[model samples]
Target: MGFWHTMVEVFPRFMPVLLEGAVIAVEVAAGALVVALAGGLVLALATLAPLRPVRFAARAYIEIIRGTPALTQLFIIYFGLADIGLGLPPLAAAIVGLGGNGAAYLAEVYRAGIAAIHRGQREAALSLGLVPTDVMRYVILPQATRIMVPPFCNFAIQLLLATSLVSAVAAPEIMFRARNLVMETYLSPHVYLLAAMLYLAVSIPMSHLTARLEQRLKRSR
Candidate 1:
């Protein structure tokens, strides 16, 4: 039988399964992003803290997480932690691992965004009887948000693609299901190609949206 003919036959059976996996992938990405966003904000704040030790500690975390392979981190969370009686379920491990990894990256993104705001604005807010917390909440973050949005969108796309990595831990995301289907059907090329297409279907639209957002931000400036 021809390859296309084989694909046509398997496509119907394959697509539904893959779509289910894709939903899980989306869920993992969304959960991880929430973790990342919250952790990143805290890390960013820590890095900018007045105390030298706090800043050093935050920077160290960013470096260590940035230095390591995410897959290894996932393994540590899922497999290694199990040996120490701290076992997490596959989906939970994937979310925490990816979220922890992404926190380091988004910390830098957050820090850079916060830094891009002028020193004068912060000083002015301080001079106007605002406390440090109020200054950051009202003056600094509001402006930094405009700078942060574009990069945050880009990171979301990266995190979505990175969800494929969770398959290594048996989280049943897109690539995991694709691998299973390929093994069962022995149609590596067709199965993998469909998986790639599913990713592209989500990612390409996000890329375009990010681009348009950037352009709009530029115009508004």
Candidate 2:
């Protein structure tokens, strides 16, 4: 009863400020997604390169990024880089760090999707005089996109939630604003609960969309 009373008192005051932060969170997620998609695609192609050294380097990057904690990566981008005069703004650092981390994961997703397409399709494309790039662009990726869509959506949701980590770097996303509110109001429980709700508001829809995509994919299969 006491908690409910406090929540009622805080709700109106807290919501508007938190919504402003949510906008920034969405922006960060979108920026990071763009970076992840581009980097992941490049890394995926590199991993599949004919040269052993190229494949080895790409795999090493994927492994190293995947092996480290994301917070450390953010710190490196936001703080560590500053020591060498390569400081990025908090928002940029957040996007780059998260996107870089996400790329390693998404590269595997891209590889799996590409591999799921039959080798016969690639051979047929080649037999039609298509170069490797066109074979990938016209034949392989068109089919692989379907296989990748659901996982991509899933990863987007994960990335959205992971934006909370950026608060450590003072990027002023949802959790960062929530922490500030808690500090000012000394209402940790109420503020943090509202923050969680804000994240859910975005994440729930994304999760639903991912589920729908998976269902559609299964039906098509």
State, as a TM-score between 0 and 1, how close model 1 is to the true structure.
Answer: 0.97
Per-residue lDDT of model 1, residues 145-180, tens digit only: 889999989999999999999999999999999999
Candidate number of the best lDDT: 2
For residues 1-221, what per-residue lDDT tens digits would candidate 2 score against the true structure? 99999999989999999999999999999999999999999999999999999999999999999999999999999999999999999999999999999999999999999999999999999999999999999999999999999989999999999999999999999999999998898999999999998888889988998898899898998
Candidate 1 lDDT (Cα, whole model)?
0.94
**For model 2, what is the alpha-carbon lDDT of residue 204?**
94
Model 1 misses residue 186 by how many Å? Answer: 0.8
The segments of candidate 2 whose C-alpha lies over 4 angstroms from its true place after superposition are: none
Q: Candidate 1: give the clashing pairs.
A: none
Question: CA lDDT, every prediction?
Answer: 0.94, 0.95
Off by over 4 Å in 1: none
